[model samples]
Target: MGSPAMADGYINGVPVDCYCTDKQGQRIEVGETICLQVDGRMFMAQCQMSLNVPMWREVSPGCLSSGLTAPLQSVDPSIHTLGVDVEIFATKS
Candidate 1:
């Protein structure tokens, strides 16, 4: 798993739940996994909470395919797609 830096946020003196954001500024809820390509390398990543902070942990050794069957929660009203090699399925909330 890749160790990415994490930063937390606060609102009105209350700590808020952390969410993972991609390059396109789409928010991914915790416990969700997504295929990401960083530094020209593709990997499967999941949003996890560690030590009260949210971070992306690599789950798969490498990306095998583009189709992801995991159900996704809608964070944005507009539909979006990742790279040509990655396909994301999201349901409107």
Candidate 2:
């Protein structure tokens, strides 16, 4: 499962929580997994972020890691305040 990250920010031309950060405190310039916990079920999203605007909403739709590339169920807005480790790339997972 991926870590919990905010969808409303940016790090190095990418969405803050949806991209990888390296030890040099730099954004890895690559896509990453954003995990979402909805109603006790964890879903994964494959993200590729560019700008920090509506793109955050676009690349964050979760899909299964394997079968069926379609998106998972929509996230319930009621479950807010997801606590995740915020780090720049290069930090060990």
Candidate 3:
């Protein structure tokens, strides 16, 4: 697969750690970029796995959820495989 450029956006509330993995025995490389936006806050990270296997993982800090109050926007469906899960949180003010 071709590596996509880094995408920028925002994520609301406190950002929780995220992980991505390929469970279909495919080769995915690290350093590839996946852009994500949650609740308006944008996040950018390099791909962390580069081998054909069954899983890739990404872990982000909680600050990615800063300044979030609403729900996340609809994500584009062409950039990733199905069944991916995201988790987020907010700090008590």
Candidate 4:
């Protein structure tokens, strides 16, 4: 709705992406620091949407089948205790 995740108004800017998900595996708002962990290295970015919507449109068309794997953890500023665990990836295009 607002500016898209990337400057060009695209969500899948990188071959890989990260997300902060709730207990039900639903994505929440992008926090102050959304972190992704791949190969034990962490990458951080900002999320642009709220958790109220389903994220079907945000996904890249071929991303899932393109060797994408998620092992992520993101810091939700809304939570005072701990940062939420998220989806990370192994991606190639």
Candidate 5:
């Protein structure tokens, strides 16, 4: 999930254990098997996945005598991808 904050946070309650030093540096652990069904076809795969939230900023001005405030924000899973070898199962007649 996405949240507005200065530091990092979790996604779907899953913790980020590893860090990468670059434009993008975050890792997520997903289960081995993923299943998808479309129309009457079923697909299964063993996959690796990731979730990312790009960094952002938000500025808010106070009313009256109050000063201005700037807060950091991030988008939830700005990018998500899955890589795996998929298998298609056929039904028997």
Candidate 6:
């Protein structure tokens, strides 16, 4: 099985202590990008940390391809065109 997004490997000796959890309760390491489906639209989100808070910030308006079973024809218009900034917040443990 393929994942909806790919997790980036750590750079030489660089360590990441922050991470965000997805809707399914999966752990997303900082700097990792993931594809998420919201309301019928596909989006690309990156895990990031802000003020010690872990959050997923939308990096792309739409996802052209996701390894999931969902087809690509399902994405709606640009998320920016909707005048909304999508962000998912997760508590750090």
The candidate scoring highest on TM-score is 1
lDDT, residue 22, candidate 2: 35
lDDT to native, each model = 0.72, 0.44, 0.40, 0.41, 0.35, 0.67
Clashes of 4: 3
lDDT by residue (tens digit), candidate 4, 3-92: 544433335453224445643666655443334444565444444444333232232222223443453234444665344344333345
In lDDT terms, which candidate is top? 1
* Residue 48 CA displacement from its true place in model 3, Å: 1.3
- Distance from true position, residue 9, model 3, in Å? 30
Q: Compared with the true structure, what per-residue lDDT tens digits does model 5 show for residues 1-93?
A: 355331244555676543322214323223333333445544553333334543221122221233434431232333431322234344557
Of 3 and 5, the candidate ahead on lDDT is: 3
Local accuracy of candidate 2 as per-residue lDDT tens digits, 1-93: 233234445454465444454335555434555554556655554344445432212234455565533333354435642433346334785
Instruction: Write out the backbone clash pairs for model 2.
Output: 21-88, 21-89, 21-90, 22-89, 22-90, 23-90
TM-score of each: 0.51, 0.22, 0.21, 0.22, 0.20, 0.48
RMSD vs true structure, all candidates: 14.5, 19.6, 20.5, 19.3, 24.8, 18.9
Model 3 over residues 1-93: C-alpha lDDT tens digits? 223222111124333233343335343355444444456755554455233322323455332435634432355446652535443234456
Evaluation by lDDT, superior candidate among 1 and 6: 1
- Superposition TM-score, candidate 1 onto the true structure: 0.51
Worst 10 residues of 6 by lDDT: 2-11
